[model samples]
Every structure is written in C-alpha cells, then in structure tokens.
Target chain A: MNKIPALSPTVLLAVALLIYPLIFSGAFYLDVGVTFLLAAISASAWNIVGGYAGQVSVGHAMFFGLGAYAPLLCYKLYGWTPMAGIPFGIAASVALAILIGIPTFRLTGHYFSMATIAVAELIRIYFGTWDLVGAAIGLQGPATARGWWDLTFRSELPYYYIFLTVLAVLLSFTYLMERHRFGYYLRAIKVGERAARSLGVPVQQTKIRALVLSAMFTSVAGSLYSVKTGFIDPESGFGILVSVQMVIIAALGGAGRLYGPLIGALILIPLQTATNTWFGGGGTGLTFIVYGGIIVLIARYEPGGIYDLWEQISPRRWRRKHAS
Target chain B: MLLLQVIVGGLLLGAIYALFSSGLTLIWGMMNFINFAHGEFVMLGMYVSLLVVMYLGGGPAAFGFGAAFALFVLGVVVYLSLIRYVLRGPMLAQILSTFGLALLLRYTAFWIFSANFVSLPQTSLSGTINVGGILMPIPQLVAGVIAILLTIGLHLMLTCTTIGSQLLAVSEDRGAAMLMGIKPDRMQALAWGLSAGAAGIAGALMAIAYPWSPSVGETFGLTAFVVVALGGFGSVPGALFAGLIVGLIQALSAFWFGPIYKDIVVYALFVALLWLRPQGLMGKA
Candidate 1:
C-alpha cells in the first residue's frame, strides 16, 4: 500500500517464482509447480473474456482442445516437432473465436454461456469420433525426445520454466492491457452492454476481440499441456472439466484482477496434488468436493476472491486510506 | 415398421426430456436464475428410486413418488441454504454457486455410490407390451405416459390454480407481489420444489430403462439445458415440442450415423438454432 515500495512485492514475487523450482528440486514439487503454471496460464487467459468482459464462457475448452491437437497432429502427420504446431493452434483458435463469437455474442448472459457449451461439445464429440486425429483413442507425442525441437524432457523442471515463461509473457501483456483503452472498453461492456454501446463502445467487436485474444492464449496453454504430458486425449483436451477448471481457478483467484488467477493457481494446484497423493484413486472425488466447496464459499462470502479479502483486511490498506 | 418404432421411442424419450426440462424452465421463468445443479437433482432422484426399490422392496408407484417427494425436500433445502444467499451476490456468484453445488452433489454421489453403474431390479414395471405390431417396453411406455400427463398437469395447474397465479405474480415483480399478500420467498421456494420434483420423477423414470452412474447427471443436465433453450426458456409447451424434436433428432441421428455422432448432430442443431433465433422456438425476445 505504500507508494515508496509498491513495486517491491512484484519484484519479490518474480524472484520467488524464479527460485521456486530450485528450492523444491524434487520431482513431485516440480510436477505440482508445472501444473500450477499451466493452470495459471489458462485461468489468466480465461480472465481476458470471462473476467474482464464478463462473458462467462463455459466452453473455452474447445480452443484448448484445438491447441492441444494442432501440435500433436503436426507431429503425427508431418513428423514435425510439436512446438511447430503452436501457430496453427493459435490460428485455429482465433478462427474459432470469430466463428463462435459472431453468433454467440448476440445472446447475453446464460444464453451466451450455454451456446458456447454447445459449440464446444459439438467440437469435442467431433474430435472423439474423427479417425484422422486418432478418434477416441487420442494422439500422443513422442515417447522420448525425438529431437531437440520435440520439447520433451525427462524432468518436470523444463516444463516448469517453459510454462512459467509463458505465464510471465501473458501476465505482462494483461498488465499492459489493463492500463489501456481496450481493457477499459472490456470492463465497460461487462458493467452494462447497453450502456457501453450507448457511450459509443463497439460492444460486439470488442467482445469478439477479447474472445480472440483469450482463445489465442488458451490455445498456447493447451499446446504446452500436450507437450508436457506427451499425450492429448479427447477428454483431457476438450472435456467440460477442462473449461470449468479455467473458470473456477480464475474465479477463485479474483477474476479481472491481473494477478488473481496466478494466486488461485498457486493455492489450488498444490491442494489438488496433495489431495491426490493422500486419497490415491478416490482422490478425484474429494478434489471435486473441495473445489465445489471453495466455489460455494467464494460465491457466498467473497466473490471478489482471496485478494479482495486481503484488500479489506490488510493493515497497509487501512493506513494508506486513512493517510490519503 | 422400424422407423415407426424409432419414432415412438423418440417421442417417449422426448416426453421425459420435457418432464425434466419443464422444471428447469420454471425456475428460469420465475427467478431468471439457472440452476446448474438441476441435473444433479435428477441424479439424486435416480438414486432415491434405487434406494427405495432395493431396500423397501417398493414397486414402481412407491419409488416414483418417493423420488419426487425426496427431491422436493432437497429443492427446498438447497434454495434456503445456498441459492437464497447467492441470489443477492454478483452475477458470477449466481452462476458459479449452482455450478459448485453441481460438482459437490455429483462427487458426493460418486463417493457414496462408488461410481458403479446401477439399475433397478425388475419390478412390476418390467415387461413389454405390444401396441399394434410394434413392441413397446412397458417401463418406457408408462414413464412416457406419466411424464406427458404430469407435464400437462403442471401446465394446467399454473394456468388454472391459485398457487400457480401467486407463483407467476412473484416472478413478474417481486416488489409488487410482496405488496400484494404474497411472500415472494415462499413462492420462489415452492417453484424450486416443483421444478426439482419434476426432475426427480424424470430421473426415476429414466432409471427404469437405463443403467447409470453418478456421472449420468452431466449428460442429462446438458440435455435438459438444450431442451429448455430449444423450447424457449420459460414456455412449458415449447419445452414439450422442443424436447420431442431433440429426442427424435438424437434417436434418428444415432441410428443413422452411429451413437457417437448423435450428440454432435443435436448440439450442431442447437447452436444453429441459437444463432438463427436467440429467443428460442417459444421464448419471448
């Protein structure tokens, strides 16, 4: 809250993130770290539209699925490195955003959300049955690194850094956007579409642009996931759970805030891994229960998320306000 | 003959879709709130019916009513405990609360039921009946008939009854209704009960013909959403017609293009429908 040291926390946080893998060099902690970064990437991407624009899309998984597939497909068909598929994934997701956004943006609130779900489900079902992409069996990356470009590695450390780099880029971009006119337009639309339009905000075009940007990042995150796991199953790629996770993580962190999702990922991914370790095979059910509980509590008490609670409770915030 | 059989089956399935979807549509109409956990209510209904049959040695009549009654109670409890609180929160909260409730309900069922698919033991509802030359399974036939009857009954009650009028009044304008002798809370609670009770019965009926696990709710929930949207969000009759169309499309497409593509066909049409008529087939713009 102090003006003299406002930038220190961010610098410290960056330093911590940089040193995290080194401090917890164990495979388990690194795996969780990598997962956290992946979740952070997707959740942050989802915030562009869902958080800022208040679109509440429950089907961003389709873009993630497309992203996951493009790289693997490139490897499967052309014997090229999976990383080479990143642009294709981004392109496809952008195109899909245009296709979906034009029609779906006409509907508002629940209607728009449901329409996105329908489109995503359609894509998932198609992917599940399409033999060219290995149908229900799904596609896999190289078992081991075929070459330097494969992006495959034995340790989780590489993925941690890779995902962290992506998250850093995404967060930096979002930070800039938050201070820009485009971000203002998105927030304006979120407050009231009609009012924003009345004030001369190009509501439809702005929403589509936000969605395109969100989809591009989401696709990249998906590409990273497939690269990390060396697998891309239909369920993992395009499942509703995948989409819901992005929403939940963003909501948990504090949607619309630049660092909300990163914080959410920091807490949630570790909790999830811990639960899985403790509960073993039945851990999934418990994890969902926990996730559900968090969502309910957040909705009931602090919809602004943990950061919002921190703002209210922090002594620094109080002192700063009183001083002003 | 085969096509007729398929059509009949589709209609029967459609009737069930209408049965559950009407409950969802009712909540949407009354409160402008979408209960993402509606399908979880149905899943619980299936389990309720299963429990009644397996433990109490109940027949179809008992289990059907038992499921409905249980879900009605649950509906009221959920509204009072969770939905009521979140209703005052932000739009995101409103959306995510029910979704969270959904995950909670679904996984709890998984924990309790062990994720194994279960079905009712053959009771009096089991058997096949011949209508003309085509054979119709009695469970589905009865389920369909009851679903249609109940949906129609619900429609009439809303149109003709005092309670229905009060409910509609609350939905129209809570402030105005509150000024009148009506307690908006009670009416809304009643609406949830009725909506969930309908879903409960739909689940019980579907259980007769299908093997299901806790995850069954996900599919049924999505299907109910499609039915509700396609029929027009708040229109009961629209739900009926739309439900039939979806069922028929799903059935025919599954039969023609294989089971995997059926959902694709349905969702494609649904998205296209939304694009063409965002208001839905029976909804007011």
Candidate 2:
C-alpha cells in the first residue's frame, strides 16, 4: 500500500529474518531458512532473463552446475581457495552464455531455449558417467578445510548469512536493472522485436546483454549452493527438471517484478517440503499429480502469475479511477 | 557382417523414429508449432496398449492393434479439446499449453501406475529372423513395415483425399482457405488428431521393441524434434529419411564414442545444421 511506503518492504524483511531466528530457536526454522535461501537465489537469478528479458530459458542448470563445479574442482585439483573460483565460475558461465546465445538468438522464441536444455543434460550425463569427478559416486564437499579462505564453514550460520547476502545483492542488481537504460530497451524488445527495431532499439545486442548479465549473477549463486551443500552430482545439478523448477518459480512469482522471486520461493518451497515429509521420502505419484495440476491451472488461468494477481487486489489499484 | 548389422539396426530404429516423427512433422508442417508434450502421447500410447494386454491377456498381436486404434480415438479427443485452439495463437501458447498437457498425462500415469519401469504385459511378437549371419528382430521389422505404410497412407491422405486437400489449403493460407469454404480451425484440429494417432501407433511399436514408462516421452520427443528439423518442417519423405539418418548416427555413435555422448553429438549436429542450413535438408529455398 502507498500508505505503508513501497521501499520499506525489503528493510522489514531483513529485520524479520534477522529476528525470526532469535524468536524461534529450533531445527525447523533453520530448515526453512536454508530452503528459502536456495529458492530465493535461484528464482531471483532466473528473473534477470525470464522476468526481465522474457527469454524463457529452460536450461539455467547449466550455469548452476558450472558454478558448483568450478569451486569444488579448483579446491580438489588445483588447491585454489573457493574465493578464487568465483571469478572462474562466472567466466565459465559467461562463455557458455555466449556459446549458447550466439547461434540460438539467430532465430527466436523458445526453440533456442529448449535446445539449450538438452545441452545441459548432455553435460550432466558426461560428467555423471565420467571418472573425472568420481563418476556417479559424487564428490562430497570437503568438511575440514584448514583455513577460512576455502569458504567452508563448520556451522549453518555462515551459509545462512552468505546466501542472505547473495539474495540481497541479486535483488538490488535486478532492481537497479529494472530501472536502467538497458532495462528499458529489454522491455521495449519484449513488446515486439521488429517494432523495437523500427524504433531504433538494438534488438540483438540488447538480448545478448540481458542474457550475459543474467548468467553472471546466476553463476555466483550456483557456486554458493555447491559450497553450502558440500556435494554435487548429475541428477542434482544440470538436469532439465531443475531448470523447469526455476522457471516455475519465476512464473509463479510476478515475472518482471523486483521482489516477485522471493515471494514465489516462500510459497512453493514450503509446499514441496510438506509434501515430501508427508510421503516420507519422495511420494510416488500424488505429489507430482498435484504439482502438474497446479502448473496447468496456472497456465490456463493466471499466466501473469500470483504476484500480478496480488497487485490487482491491492488497495492502491482498487482506488477509484478516472472514467475512460 | 558389420554392414548387415548396421543396415538392419538402422532400418529398425529408423522405423520407430519415422513413426513418431511423422506426427511431429505434420503438426509442424501445417501448424509451424512444436508440441513440447509430444513425447507424452507416445508414452501414453505405450501405457494404453500395456493395460489392454494386461486386462485382455492376449499377445501384442491380438490386442495391440485394437489398443492402438483406441488410442487414436483418444488422440482425436485431445486435439478437439485442447491442441486445436493453439495452432494460430503465439508460438509460446502452443509450446506451453502442450507442455502442460504433457505434464498432466505424465503425472497422471505416475499417480495411477508405479514408476518402476514396466514393459508391455505380453510379448507376443517374439523370435528373430536371421539373414547373412545377422539376426534381425521380427517386431522391429513389423514396426518398420507399419511405419512405412503409415507414411504412405499419410502421403496419400494429404494428396489424394478431399479432407486432406482442405487441411493443406488451411495450412497454406488461412484467409484464402476460408474464402475457399474451408474451416481452418476444424482442419487444424483434424491434423492434430491424425498426428497424435500416428504417434500412438509409433508408441505401440515402441512397446514391442522395448518397454514403456511414464516419463520416457522426453528423449523420443527430442529425437522427433531433430528429425522434424532435419527433414524440413512440412515434408513427410524428408522426415522419413532424416529419421533413418539419425538412427544410423545414433547407433554408430553409440558404438564409436559412448552411449552417453550420442545424445550430445546429435544435438551438436542439430545446432550446426540449424546454423548452416535453417530450412533443413529437403526444405525449399
């Protein structure tokens, strides 16, 4: 509401996270926090392209996997600190972004996006079956690093703050992007590329720029997840299903909004956890049935997603307006 | 011996690819749309036939054809209710809606049927045909023959039948078709029904060769996409030839490199082909 002031929402949220642990000191709160951080980062990173540029990438897990691997691979093989791997991960993701985006953007729409998904799977499978990362055995995140430079922590609190910081940085970056010149160009292109071209908007460059920036931020977060989790594998990383989940999160949240991804993570991640618990370990069928049903219902009815629905009912939007 | 093995394996695999890709190619040719849920139809066909065999206690031969026929009817129902409306809409709508439908079918199977991989109830088509020191699969031969027949039948339908002409007219130009007394919407629906039915037959054939599970649709769907792209969007013969080439590439690649790399190699080829020639092998300039 305008009465509450729009900018205060984030400040209040930070206060809540910082204080919530103080009030509720249990394993449950920690579980929610950990899960929330994961979803928040993934969804927010996805928004850079899906929400802002509307590229509909179904293969974000590629960057995520690269991010996860860079740090771990460096630590294990080259004996480099995890901090140094951040730039390496970003570089790898950027290279992949260009590799995928260059040829893919030549045409248009979701074909390129869908094709990228298969590539992600290919990489995952190659890694999974290869003896390089111990194959399917999965390399466990090193537990006893000698120094803080490795980015490994003995407690969950360090990870909590790290992801919290990542979430903040991503949100701010996306917020600033939504209000900038490139942002306006992206919005214009989303309307109609040809029309935007007619209006002198550099269509090709703008799309590439959106994707590159999105990939950089997403990679940073992916690295964090790998370190936090302490292990990585094919099925857990660069699979099409993970990409689908990220997309669903972006869609469920308002696509183009600054804070929508966080809102999305709050709703769905909890639902997933509750479902898993009820079934006691990946319930056979009913969960997916409900999940698929929700996707169908949303696709049919609420293409604008839940956040857009919320905005429609807001008091500000509901105020009396001038007649047409 | 190598030549015989490659030839036999490629042909059999080609038949399965042709059957599935025919439906996809037809939809793309007329509609210029790709259904992300396409693989699900094939998966559904497999399951349906599986259930029929389980209930009726007959071999794949006795009830397989009838089950496939029943699935064809369901395909028509799907087209009527869902896929028809999206043909003329934005590309995103068709892709997303079909994806949703696919998810619906996949999860519905998961909910009802266990996910622990089940084959067709009865394997009626058993036995091998050996020729020149190379053993050929009988069921695969049946699948190939049927695939070729369906392709020919589809070709005949498109060229020789009035209904086919109506469908072609709509695809060429919607406004022009309307002027010529054709209902473009209905034609689009019919195209979807026919395509789904073709995929159903492919699925039944697939069950004879291997097995069916709920989520097995994605890999086959990806293969069909490659074939459709390679063969030229609207060309039936192109799809057939392309499917065969893909099967050979896959089989050879599986032997040359590893099975895992085969997918990557083909997709990389698809991307390169797209880059060098977007219209595809048989498409008109």
Candidate 3:
C-alpha cells in the first residue's frame, strides 16, 4: 500500500472548508461550520491540560466565562471594542487560572476536578448576582457598524473564516506541542506525576504552563463566542454544561492526539444541532442522554476514544509502511 | 435572638446535608469510588416518596420508608450492573460512569415528569414549634433529628456489627475477606444499598420542606460533594460534623451577606480548607 503524505489530507480538508461557503451559500450550513470550528478550538485548547497533563478540570467554563464577559462588560460600561477587550480577557483568564491552579494543583485526580467545579460554581453564582455584569439579565454587545474592529459581521462568512483560521492556528500549535519537549513532559506527568517529579520533570511548573496555555486559548474562544453571538449571560457563559461539552468532545475524539478534538467536534456539533432542532421544544434531554451513553460506552470499553478505535481498525501494514 | 434562630435553622439544614452525604461517604470508603449519580439517587427518592403519596396515599413514615426501599434496590442494581464494571476501568471511566448514570437518571425524570417543579402533599410532619424566641419548622426539626440519628446509627453499625466488620474487612482487603469466607460483592452491594437508602430517606425528609424539580439533584449533588469532602471522604461522623458546619456557615452567611453570596462563602471556605488539608478533616493521611 502506498503511504499518503501527512500534510496532504489536512491541506485538502482546509481547501474543502474554504470552498464550502462558496458552494453552499446558506447561512445555516455556515453557522454549523463555524460552530464546529469553535468547538474544535475549545476542545483542542482543553486537550493541552486535560489530555496531555492528565488534569481533568471541570471548571474551565470559568475561563470561558471570563473571556466572554470581560469583553462584553468593557463594551457595555467603557464603550470599548471587543477587539480591545480580547487581550484583557486573556490576561484575566491567565491570572485567574494561576490563582485557582496554585491551590487546586496541590491535589491530585478527583480532588482537583472537584475543586475546579467548586471554583466555577462560585464564580457563576457571583456573576449571577453582581449587577455590574447585568446580573442574570446578561450583557448585549452594542449595535455597531459591520467591521473587523468590533468583530460584528452582517453575514456569517467572515466569522466562519475567522473561526477556521483560529482552529488552524490552534491545531498547528497542538501539533508542535505534541512533538516538543514540553509535550513529552506533559505526557510524563500524566503517566505518573510523582514519577515525573522524581525524574526532574518540574511537574507543577509544567502542569501550570499547560493550564495557562489551555486557559488562554479557551478565553479567546469564549470572547469570539460572545462577540459572534452578541450576548453573554452567567448561565450561558459559565454553565457546567459548557465545561462538560469540552471534556466530552476531547474525550470522544481522543484526548492527547493532535486531531482528536477536531474529530470530536465534527461528530458532536452536527449531532447537537440535530438534537436541538428535533427535540428543543419537547423539553427532553435527548442530546445529553445520548452523550451520557457514549461517555459510558467509551469509558467502559475503549478509554482511548474514537482515535484509538481508528488506529486499531486501520491497516497495520499501511501504518508500518508509512512510519518512515 | 435573630442569630440564635439563624443558628438553629442552619443546624437543621446541616443535618439533612449530613444525612444525604453519609451514603456518599460510605460508598467512597467502601470502594474508593465517588458516585456522581448520587444526587440523582436522592432525586429518585424524592419522586418515590411523591409516587407513594400520590398513589398509595401513604403518610410520611410509609413514603419515607418506601423511598428507602426503592432506592436501596436501585443502588444494588446499579452496583451490579454499572459500578462493578466501571470500577475495573481507569479513574476517568469510574468518574464518568456515574456522571453518565446521573444524566441518564435526570433526563429520564425530565421525560417522565416534565421540567416542572413538584412538592409532597402535607403529611403528618408539618407546622412549626416555637422555642424561646426562635420559631422552628417541625418538618425541618424532624428531618434534622432523623438525619443525626441515621448518621450515628450508620457509624455504630460500622463499628459494632459482624456484618459491618465483614464489610470493613472487604474494604480493607478483598482477598483477605474472601479467605475469611466473606462475599465481597454482596457486602459491597449492601454498602451501595445502604448509601442509596440513606439518600432516599434524606430526599423524603427534604421533600417535606423544599419544592424541587429533576434539576434539584445538581444542587444537592454539589452540596453532598462539599459535605463529604469537608467531613472526610470516608467518615460518616465526619460527614455529619461537616454537614452541620456547612449548613451553619450557609445560614449565617446568607443572613449576613445575602442568599447568593452564601454559596460563595461555603465554597471559599471549602477550597481554603482543602488547600490546608487535602486529605480532609477525618480522612486518613
């Protein structure tokens, strides 16, 4: 069997995506595509810490919320553009991550996960009551002229391209990290933090660095999400479901792998859109029910996720032939 | 006088927290597995109580006991079917299995009952009693009393009974217990049953005072986690102590700062406490 070049498939996929808007010319399809890209970006960012460092944080919605609200609040209160607020949002998320990580990183496994949830809940409750962020009413982006400065677009085309670009950048970043010494250290920590530390891996520092990177990217996604949606609320911004979705997407695709989150987003976003369309008014949590079932089956049978499944089912002879 | 009332109210609320959390702590101690679906178990208990009252016209005692029995069976079934298998998998699988079960149970309730809130009918446990200048709701008082009694009873059972010794032996060393002719599976199933039964009773007791929907489990689940963590993951008495402390903190903070900030106070304290003592107050180091 002839081995295909690694970059060819990715480039082909990118070309296909670029021409998709031109071919489809429908807002719904563009919306779904953008959503997929956004989910992909978020999940990939999460993979840095969750997949690589082996720290499962359920409170990542806190960074997402911060990324979302910082920009919206600045726009609402200070008459600043969301573009101007993005840096501040990223900085705030990083700072908060440090504060949270300092205490939470001391604990391991489930304890750390629980602590993250608590912190996120605390922030959610605070935002729910704090009037400065409009409390539970949430904040709306100002009605502005269609321009890159404000990040508001009349058509979904620009947002689609922006999301695609962000996804590409993040994917490239993850790809680099995967082959780098930093990535190796993270994997080492994941296998055994104590052993990693004994091997002079600087376990805490490495974990924090991974988490900061994860938080920064997640915040960027959050800012983009809020600006694109033109609204931000505590529930929508920092909802536990949002955190769970990121985890699910990463896990489903194959955590720690370069293309894992993208694959996960592809599968999940379409399913989410379909379920919401079909069962939205029915008040049945069918989407979540399916998600739950998938998580169980994956965890029980194949903790390696879909990527691992793919590897197993792929032709071994082809894989070995392509190793060079 | 106002502070006294707040303190009393907090104690009552804390007792119920302890009651619900004891089961979670027991399961953790027995198997080192956290039940993410524990809140759903309590929610099911609430619905069981509601069903018994609506259909069978049972009083508080009958419905409370009914919830316990029903959820006890559920706990055992879940252990045999879901938990037992997941336990052998990775830590992520163990955590997410119950999480999946939680979503399954919660959404099933949503499908059957819809999203609307429901409350129990006025049973024998109603009204309030005034002591000094403080007015105590009778239902809360009874729930609190029952919660303390159940927690202590569980503690005593673990310390005193032959079955308890066998259960502890299995937890201590499954192979050793097997050599002693103890069935680890049966004992573990019983622990799950007891844990879930306690949650059911807690739900019934809580239903007396609080109107709830299927989503109520989220709040209870988070609270149970906090309580169990605070009390020490595997300690029944520690859960009781932590639950009361949390309830008291919540009540006092809610009174002083406002209702919304109450969670902030509890969680801040919780995080700080965990930071200082990662093993928790009573958990083995």
Best by DockQ: 1
Candidate 2 lDDT, tens digit per residue, B55-150?
Answer: 876776655575557666776776776566655443334445666676678878876786768876447577888876898888877877877787
Against the reference, the lDDT scores of all candidates come to 0.88, 0.75, 0.86
Error of 1 at A244 (Å): 2.4
Cα deviation at A28, candidate 3, in Å, is 0.6
Candidate 1 residue pairs in backbone clash? none
Clashing pairs in 3: none
- lDDT-best of 1 and 2: 1
Residue-level error in angstroms, candidate 3, position B223: 1.1
State each model's TM-score restricted to chain B.
Answer: 0.97, 0.92, 0.96
In candidate 2, position A290 carries an lDDT of: 64
lDDT for model 1 comes to 0.88
Instruction: Rank candidates, lDDT, best first.
Output: 1, 3, 2
Where is model 3 more than 4 Å wrong at Cα? A1-4, A322-324
Highest-TM-score candidate = 1
What is residue A148's positional error in candidate 1, in angstroms? 1.8
| Local lDDT at A220 for model 1 | 99
Better of 1 and 3 by TM-score: 1
- Give a tens-digit lDDT track for model 1, residues A209-269: 9999999999999999998898998899999889878988999989888889988988889
Of candidate 2 chain B, the 10-residue stretch with the lowest lDDT total is B87-96
